[model samples]
Target: MNETLPMTGKMNIAANDDWWRGAVIYQIYPRSFRDTNGDGIGDLRGIVKGLDYIADLGVDGIWISPFFTSPMKDFGYDVADYCGIDPSFGTFEDFDAIIAKAHDLGLKVIIDQVYSHTSDEHAWFHESRQDRTNPKADWYVWADPKPDGSPPSNWQSVFGGSAWQWDGPRRQYYLHNFLASQPDLNVHNREVQDALLDVARFWLDRGVDGFRLDALNFSMHDPQLRDNPPSGVPMERVTRPFDMQDKVYNQSHADIPAFLERIRATIDGYSGRFTVAEVGGPDPLAEMKAFTEDGKRLDSAYNFDFLYAPELTANRVRSSLSNWDGTPGEGWPSWAFSNHDAPRAITRWAQDGDVDRMARLSMLLLLSLRGNPIIYQGEELGLPQGHVAFEDLQDPEAIANWPHTLGRDGARTPMPWEANAPQAGFSNANRTWLKLDEAHKERAIDRQRSDPGSMVSYTRELLALRNSLPALVDGASRLLDTPEEIVAFVRTSDQGDVLCAFNLGEQAIDWAPPEEFASARMVADQDTVNGGNAIRDRIEARSGYWAK
Candidate 1:
């Protein structure tokens, strides 16, 4: 690996018309992002108020999670209407204002499109479940019961229990990959696919720049309703019963790609529009590649490769990057260490006292990668996971699984904007929907925006550095040989070659620079060594550097 060779064949993503390639996208979970009203729920206007703050971060775009009409059972993920905005989130006029403000700030707005399922309260689902002969009767996944009156298959819901739910009027079972209220759409039906495509058209026409397709792989299922095979893997900790099976028939369906082609065609009609699918399962890389394989599919896709990893290591980074090799016709990959669905990265990966240092290093590491990097809101502040008491928990997963899973509520806690203001300036209300992470007040945006050495300020510098360098933006990355404590790689392009190195361990270790990197100029970095194996050459704990 030390042979000093040109790494993977270089593929310039920007050469294509896709602007999302190698961009840094800030993910804003609508409810937790900011709340402008005293009603305690975040609305579109709240996001509008924060646009300038987001733009100043130097990111290329913003991906706002679901804000559509919903029952709030699964939060906004359970969509009641595709074209309408939920009242709690604001009106369509409020959405228009958000679109206008985001564009004025030169930030592309990517809204969530939850095409996999719809809330039971949705008009379509409501009509479809009524006596089975309605105009939209086949709009959802409805199946007949077996001779024994059991569910059609052994499929399981992601939340727990059988995937099939009995509908009283239809007298048949409807498949739901999540909560029973969230009935999976029958993408096999041409009308359903067309309707979803129209939903995409509705947003595109509304001036939204892009979409973050939620659970895109789960949009379709096997029409046969075959049972998923058992993985036979021993369960050390059964967080959910869904983990028992391989999830073959219920998701990652064969027909999903053809439907994606249709979605892509609709998006292609609108110039400069982008689409990224969020795919997750036991094996997501293959599906991620398939979804974005060609220019005709989604612009990019991201899986839980890093989001759900138990640990962060050099080998893991190298392996994940290798999968996306940046070869011609290969789809672009996106990476996220934390999001609304998972626990905070610092709490998950860093040692107790090393969060601040690890946060800086993680920012550098993420920005230096080969593809687009998604920064979860408050990540710049280095917010650790909040401790949510059992009685205070609103997340169904946390409540059901209890201590087994970390649950998503911790990451979805309200973002702290001010250190002393009520609810950390998230709202003027006496109470917010979810409690603000009190520990995050110390790392609030107001506090870090002023301190030059703060994590938030360092994030700005890192982004600025990344934007200024083509090697960091769209270059081909090749892993370098390093000791177990270090994760090192080289990004090469016509602009130049850059060596990126990180110390993952918690000790200040002596490491000698390779001959070619010895006199390399410092481009962008954090807590790196100074000279050679001498005392000055020791890289501090949880630090990294980029040199060219």
Candidate 2:
């Protein structure tokens, strides 16, 4: 990628508190971004080195995945120390350099805050598990076993089996919604909540811009230890017990929003701070709204609607987007088609079609949507899910449910920077934690940077277009009636109105826009409506256009 930053059309980060309202955030999985020390793992310095590349993409900010002190059990999700940087990722000074460089490039820096759980090695978890009499005894969820020595409830860990783990020291069962080593924090405790708030302050004091709360819905749980009811929805395959339960009592406690309110208050003290939560469960939309309702809890919330969808159809997109109607008191929404935890969107939605064309179409649709759009590290380059053999897999969840799911390791592979460099320019080391996708080399940054028709170029142009059009950012959106294969919507604002349409199907179709758009000129096109041409009656397969 180019090291020189673009001079014009950069995001203006002037002291606007609502900068994230419709901003685009590029997510960087630190370990997979770039390895500067030849350790085969990305570090803070690597991110600092890549800030120019990220800023040149026209995104307003970057959300770096957790780089806190960890045991690598969940690849930084199971944070060992909320206030400390992991040795592998570098020291606090290195992190400060990242913030300085990113801010210098006019890019805000948002970081992952894993408040839901912590690695068992965490000091708080260690103290809480030690006989349950320490100062932090109640810092984590702990319960007495049933008379029969079974777990307290039927709650299942997302990884597998029971959510409870026997703690020999405390002689009580501790909760772990994920792996056994990742103990769920008792956020219901006022002291625990206060401590978490303090951690947030620590980061904000370091000049960090904001936070992306990891699994915020899983932050609190029912203290009653009630069993979760069956989902009632049938499934063809159940790889883990977690897939069967509705995840009611185990997570999404009613008190989650109360804690979020406290978090919001804490962040509000710092000017321009933004907070967005990752909420997933049986009814995520409801919880997402509650978490961000009235803007008193969080700035925005995003669910797994498009992240885990099997296909990208007009009806599917329409249905998902329709739920977030701009009703009064409704929380702001953020959208992501792919992320570190899910397979690449192109891999999931392209469905053996023209991948390159589909990639451009997806970019257009994401940028034109009303909500804040997140671009995963390699998504801009149209990278697909990397191939991770069973033997090479590192994700515990994927390994535990082998053959049933591809696991997240495929999506967490290193970013491909060069087409022919060693390890594709990710590192100088002999091997990385996860192997680079052989196919990704063809779409590496070096190759795409020079190609005008590449995914990277398309993404940059789309982002610039989005920045230029106020209608595309923080505008009122209404879905338009169109053919089943066409997803159409119009975003209207004081600045102007943008009519967006996409043909997600495999075959071209003849369609006519509403009379209002009859004379609208095409501002952006991906082989659908010709660029700078009047709206046409025919739409091409897997193509789209943005007009005003």
Candidate 3:
């Protein structure tokens, strides 16, 4: 008998199964995850070395933050060379090594591709700004300002200040929805679209499994140069002025889907490839559906569902879930608890509020949802945001929006591996690029990996339970009519049935579930406290439970 026969169970991902469906993606923020050269910053080799740890978590793929060649103003988000890696993170060859190692572990590699903008120093941008006659002048969004030297319109950058910047050479204000140095690409141009597609193909050919497109909704804009209307209501977020506008014309353009389809078609041509968009806005459901409707665009996407804002109350979760409604082919929801752009969920939602229970509840909630879930680095250990002072802040967006916003620096701290090592086991340097909180060492991965009651252990249990149940993995969710204090749902599939419920508050509440959940059995829950068959005649606040 042949040992390598079909029954041996090889991955077959390269030829079979659409890999993105119901996948679990782990997001790696390279700068602070692990430092290999003792340079006080994490690099590609360190990530490769840590691949085993991530793969052990059983994620379907890994979404690596940008490591492209560039100045580090916004870390690697601002790209100088699209096809090559920055020397700071390591060479292009080092990235290839990471890709190869990740594949060996059955962990697909997906990288963050920032296509909406590029660093000012990029050869393409530099040449495009030389003069209007340059081959690439039309390559970016360049327009003449009004006669009064005001911006082309009322558009504002996400970071700060006007979105338009004056260029001496071009004698026009070029649009940059981010920093002046990071100019927005002229995505409306066919040549620009083709060039960007070429960049995507470069990584796909190099064996990448997928891409998590950054600011995908910002890819195209209104061609008429119309002014964006100021938001009728004052922005609830006082930290940044950009949120004050309706952004109807400035972004979320109708033509963006056409460009996305082009990219999707190219991805479809490649075997075993996938694409997910990172969309952030107010009307996320409509936008998400528009992008993924009828398979014409993005494979899946996650929005600001719970990334921002305060505590995850029962009503908020219920409302957010209602937006999806688990309808057929409308759009699939990919959820995230934390990422580089937002505050760490543990600290943002729980931690000080009831760290242990919140950690367990969040883990269970994310897995039970009907979408591909993404877990951020250090989240498994229940690591809280680092305490960063003004001098230690490196993120431009955070710094630009000071006291009004806490800034993302605190959430982007180095990952803790060793409980008592220097630099929280992230680096051996006298000083790290960002401060490592001394308190987090106690919750380091090395310390928690063996503790059954630790958040990491709970995470493993929750993920394992979800994986074991077919109904929870890919199923249609029916929202159960429960109290505002409790959000319960049933996941039904051909294989079996499962129940998911969460008590979104801090106090206990009694509730009767719908008749459908009577046949379900407990699969997993907050380890320290059980919901008792999820019948819970009552449940505590910030509590969660799952039954099969």
**Number of the top lDDT candidate:** 2
The digit string of per-residue lDDT tens for model 2 on 206-295 reads 999999999988888988999999976567767788989988888988998989999999998999988989988756989998998998
lDDT of 2 at 305: 84
lDDT of 1 by residue, 1-548 (tens): 11221212112332244667777899999898889878877878889888888877778789999988899999999999989888998988899898888776667888999999999999999899887788899999999999999999999888889999998899999999999999999988999989999999999999988899999888888888889998766788566679889988889988888988999899989988888889998688889888987787888998898898877776778778878887788898889999999998878788656787678778888988898899999898899898788888999988998888889999999888899988888888887888887888898889888887788777776776676678878789887777888777888989888888877776877876667777786666664322222223567777778887
lDDT of each: 0.83, 0.88, 0.81
Cα deviation of 144, candidate 1, in Å: 1.1
lDDT of model 3 at position 61: 79
Q: Report residue 422 deviation for candidate 2 (angstroms).
A: 0.6
Ranked by lDDT from best down, the candidates are: 2, 1, 3
TM-score of 1: 0.94
What TM-score does prediction 2 earn? 0.97
- In Å, residue 336's CA in model 3 sits off its true spot by 0.9
What's the alpha carbon RMSD for model 1? 5.1
Q: Which of the two, 1 or 2, has more lDDT? A: 2
Q: Ranking under TM-score, best-scoring first?
A: 2, 3, 1
For every candidate in turn, the CA RMSD to the true structure comes to 5.1, 1.9, 3.3
TM per model?
A: 0.94, 0.97, 0.95
Worst 10-residue stretch by lDDT in candidate 3? 1-10
Q: After superposition, which runs of candidate 3 have C-alpha atoms over 4 Å from their true positions?
A: 1-15, 528-535
Clashing pairs in 3: 505-541, 505-542
